[model samples]
Target: MGLFPTSPPRIIAQHLQLDLSIRNYRTPAALSTQKYADLRNEHTFPPFAALPEELDPDLSYYEMSGFREFKHSRHWCFLAEISKVEWLARLRLVVRDKQGALVPVAFYTDDKGEEFKYRARKGSTVMILYPDQHFFLGGTTGIRLEKESFCKIVTAPLNELMALSDRVGRYSTWQAGGRTCHGCDEKKVVDLQKCAGCGMFWYCDKTCQTTGWQSKGHKRDCKLIRENGLRAMFLTDRDRFEHFIDFLLPEPVTASESTAAAVEKLSALSIGTESGGSRAAEQTAVIVKTPYKIQPIASKGKGMVASTWIPRGTRILSEPPLFRVPRDNPDISAVDDIVVSKVSQLSAEQQRVFFDLTNIHGTEHSTAMGIARTNVLPLGSDSRSGGLFPIASRINHSCRHNAQNTWNDNIGRLTIHALRDIKWGEEITICYLPTVGSYRERQNRLRATFKFTCTCELCSLPCVYSRWESDMRLRKLQKLDAQIPGLLWGDRVEEKTALGLVRSMLDLFREEGIQDASIARAYNDAYQLALTCEDECRAKVFAQRAWEARCVAEGADSPTAVKMKKAVDQREHVKVPELDEDAFEKWLWMEGES
Candidate 1:
């Protein structure tokens, strides 16, 4: 798209230095620094021009539209007057379409630039107390207001306005100014004392002052302010309206704001860190843990998308939970008992810290108990404690998971790696379902249980993909049944033969989007095959990967990952003896391949 179209520009002026030429001349089209400076200093807005002949004391003009059907709402336009004196105050006339829906029809402008700049005096001032409860949806259609259209004006004295602000704990005044005007050294020409009646705007001596009061435009703006002020305080008191006003003209998110957001994320996190209030300390570490590379997927939630390609064996992300719990028992019956009993196990000081924590579920309890009951990841192992990890919970689940997660007990961290190259713009999904069945079965389970539809690649596939997924479990079961007898007998299967079977299973599972306990077994089998062949390099890699999957599905502190890690590490240093290297070649190997 081209920048600065003929239409009203969204881009604002960069430099806020007041136009020095405006200091001497008092033109209706141009704004003077004095007027703007006064409006800003006093925290008042430009006036509303139209006034009702008979004032209704009971009624206030400001009202939130489309309250119950918020989905249909648009921008919250605060309407008021633009006066003759204010050289820079711009106005946009909003109108409803044929369907009577409110929309921005025309904008008022003082300058030719895309952005409007002012000292604050000419700008209308009104505080919205409960902005969160209201949303402004202004468009090309809806309840419309025309440019400089006269609306019934109501007046509030300076003390009343200040009183309203105080009722909401606002000590410092609130005013609207151009984003660039901050810290500007420009001097004001008009005295604010002139516009006390409207509580917005200013004027110099009569030569310049009369131009504002009559020819320049303050007369029109004065009426607009009265209407807007009454509207701002209508029905709801001024205190509740500050939040709304704040939302309409929000403070820019600076470096400090970003830092604050990061701190909030850290404070709420429950994994890895021992300290509870270590937001400053954890920020750098937390930011670093996020993957250096992130691929966009067809995300349905917030932003637009584009795509990128992926390569095999890329380390996607490595994360540590904000908090973690080791569950030894899996039975749900004893879960409450385990949660309660485990709290007492911590040291006295640790106990105090643990109880002070907040649960992700928003329950009232000690931090340890809240995390344990609400955010635990179920690792399928003998020790069934669901370990609570905060960062991990943000990752939503999908039937077809592109990345694999594992918990490292030694490091007490969670690591994730891409199994195969993933394309950008593909939604990253973990399998939420315990198991996959036919299409209908998967969909029903996802919606009823997880409360979201299964829109993963596998779920969206054609008949071929669907059929392959449907038969996967049967094939896995058959393989398991056939292998049981041999493993029971401790038959040393031929190295090549066993490796081929495991590789075949792994490939098939990837195609069918099968992420389950079976993948772990196949990985284990591959590791064993590498060990038998004395391929130390390959064995170490496979063992580690398998060990991670085992930990994620089961638990890091569980016996499985620990045992696998030990075996892999020990094998790394030990030299495998070359005794009867071909002896097992006769046991499981057929008279064929390898």
Candidate 2:
């Protein structure tokens, strides 16, 4: 017998100890079931059937099974507080419908963990981690909901989320089918060999291990992956790591800086001016920047738009160092709430500016922390918190985004550009969540971390269409992964072959209207192919695009961006020999556009 004796087996209707819940209850349904099914069919592959442990209580085993199918729009709500600020262990979101049907989403354990969303469609809104009560809505709707509409609401301060940092790992909570080792393609039988120092890559034998270390790019990448804190992220259970990425990472140095310092530095610089340009000249530059605001439009969460008109490919804004904290730094040992409350003592502007910086702390803290936590973007290399851009924060969330933002190390400022066109009043958005994997995986992530059940058109579709999207994604990743080992070994791809594969991926993104991070990697692969063919012009073009995308995804100021820029510049100015066409094609996916 099931909990619902007469109907299908459903989850516990009420709160299960320490469970996560649906915050928004009123999700609107508009499209017909058939249309929704068509849309789902248009993108996803592999129907949604219950995967083994898709939503497990333990922070591990989070991958969605291809077999599970979604039946209806899910409703998740933040629940009432259950314990003291620091020692609180469980998190529960009240799941109820606009019609009052109840579902309880629980993170039921003393073990602290973090959750992350892998895919969210454009136009989906994710609440700030520790949002004020004003944003909660119970139903999945396109319109933002009033906090008052939320019933049986339960939530704790953002400080509580931050206090339990070790327990939260971004993407650490989920597990997937075992991946075949790149070197040997071994399955369950393979022995694990951890990378020295960095401890990220695994090898099956001494020969494969040596090839990975010396010939493959693992030697260089191992250190970088560890330094950026991504090694642990990709290898660990995704759910736990998701929390870490979403909240636990130290606040970015720029985010913690004083407003006085930011103003003072901005005033002292000759940005967008000749060496002796006056402060008036700099002010003019700021005005010019206003029109070039990079609008975010592609993914759910992280929406941004120009306060004014931005031209095509315009360099929108640059950021200066607000603060700098080294990796492995420790938080000040004090009650987070108490420490956060101290911001009230600051001047209003200072308080405002402080909050504008990136932080994982939520409401109930000093007003400053809450505000800062609301608008920060990842700095890529910086393990601390992501940085905050005042102008950029105004953008909104959409799964299908248009603008791209990058941190430029050379100029020491953030830059933004239109990934696609934008009109005035259209909300700009960047995916706050990773835009990868199937629909269900993405929704689970958004609910766990952002506290909203996304009902964006992409997520609201039937299971069949969602599966199409997943299949395409899986194909791209598999193809890309196949090329890594050979390319890193200094091998090459023929131009025609490389072009063909790259074109396929690009075409797929266009079809889905997604701004995939993988596109950047594909561009880089193309650049390598061009280099192999001694096609300087093509190489330069691909490298430039690769650098720009990487800048947006990672910080422009990050080492990766800096290196890519160097390569781009070199491609433009230098010439090199072409490799054997056969070797090149084998090594890189250089299938030309047919």
Candidate 3:
């Protein structure tokens, strides 16, 4: 269940996953999650950046998930040769990792595979983003093209980032001013540790230290570590992790010049930008943007306020999530712990902002999970994945929500658009319930899910007079839903029956103060029915009506609006000849088009 004060609106909730839990536990982290960097392995075989495999006893699927979790949050490098390419339904890149293990990397969804047709080739060198969906498990393909700034190809440099990940492994142990094993990557956590000759190098055993001096190259590396004052880096007791080092990819052409040369080479790839802006080819020129401000609400804590007049269909607020969690995962504690770990890595100021957000779980086991549950919005097509949008979350709940919250795939951002015009200074709101129902139903849902009774305009109508009329309309709307299918698909459909249903649904939407995508869709259905009868000019008017409704909710630049615009521009269809407006109505719906 959601942590918000109202039941999730019907439309939005249809795609969300809800897990209900009520428990509190106090568990402090055993180790601090700290700042980490993507460091290049200067020597040796690099650390083991193990991909999850069943036969490997040294690693578990759980640990591999954590390693992937760590890599997905920041910039990561992939080194591989394209072993196979499948371009038909989707872009699937099968590449061999540094270990010579073949892994499948899928990018983008269905129709988008064509955009990067040239890049998906055999034996091509590519640098995929760290967090990309590397479906290492059986059956499923890897990577999805839907994520932001998904990946880029470093055409010139080859295999520079293919080294094993040093970021993982033995990060748990740290000691300063004490002797530690120099030769051991798997040294025990405590006891039996002694220093070698220089008082700088440590080893667990005499034989190990001796071998390290000659065979493991500690002789040269030790002298360099001591002389260069890298002893601190060698130890793990420091309060903070090391900052990121600039490592150029593909061609570390002479290690010395790779820094400057790499940046120049990768400049066209837009390396550091969080998500693409103009880089997204599908986005149209924005007409108006969502505008709102955050302010303290009486007893509600903080709420989003419209800073200016927000027109219907204006994409009011489009923002990336601070972080995300697997939506369908039933384990609440695990998800909450992951969020907490991510928060620990943020700057103190950023941490404060995250901590200050509303928590429906007052003192529940997980404050992190509480805020996430209360504020999380869907990430993709469904609630199986969700991200917490800091600003969008603050837009308080209303039974009669003024805005529509959607996961906009084109921009890869959580977008809130005004479903209805919002006046300047008005408190911006979105519906928590999946759909508006009876007053009692709304009340019960709000109490059960959010633990607060809603006082929304539609929900607060008294049971004596106001509730009756609203409930009556709602029941009728439900009945209409069942009738429309038969009229649309049945062979003996009467034109008047379909027309009556459309008019009633339109009136019901208005009476309920509803502004939704369905309104436009319903009008489009009428246009299609007219088309079935070859009523061209009459269908144009219905098509125009559908387009107007769409413009008010999706804006003129949206894909749906663009498609509607194309239909409106097809003026050639109206050449069939126009009937008088009254006669047109009778012929179109009441009487058959004869």
The Cα local distance difference test for each model comes to 0.39, 0.40, 0.54
Q: Looking at candidate 3, what is the lDDT of residue 570?
A: 81
Maximum-TM-score candidate: 3
TM per candidate comes to: 0.34, 0.39, 0.47
Rank ordering of all candidates by lDDT, starting from the highest: 3, 2, 1
Q: In candidate 1, what are the lDDT values of residues 1-594, reduced to their tens digit?
A: 001001110111111111111122122222212122122121122222111111111113233232311110111223322222111112333322222233332222212111222312232232211111111121112111211211222243333433443322211122233111111212243233334445333343445546556764446555544434331222122212212222112211223346556345333332222233322221112111122333233443322111222222233444444434556556544555566776666668755644544354444554455556544665433334455444444455666676555555555555444444333344444455555556677788766744567666666677775666556654664575467436434546466656656666766676665654567777777677777667675576567667756643544443566678787667667443322223322322323545
lDDT (Cα, tens digit) per residue for candidate 3, span 1-594: 111110000001001111111111111233223222223432211212443221122222122222212111122334566787654224667777556667676554324455555655666655442222333212353443333233444332234222212312222234342233556655454554434323334467777778778886556544543332222222222122112212121211133446555345435433443224312211211112235668998877789886554545566776777887788888877887888887777788877888888887777757877887877877754567888787787888888888877665555677677786555567888887776777788889988888888887787776668878988887787788678777877886566668778778878989988787768877887877676666676577677768767755655545566677677668545653334434555655666543
For model 1 the TM-score comes to 0.34
* Candidate 2 wrongly placed segments (more than 4 Å): 1-289, 292-309, 317-347, 353-375, 455-457, 460-467, 478-487, 490-501, 516-518, 529-541, 544-594
User: All predictions: root-mean-square deviation over Cα?
Assistant: 25.5, 30.1, 23.8
Top model number, lDDT: 3
Note the clash tally of each candidate: 80, 142, 23
- Please give the range of 10 consecutive residues that has the lowest summed lDDT in model 1: 1-10
For the record, the alpha-carbon RMSD of candidate 3 to the native fold, in angstroms, is 23.8
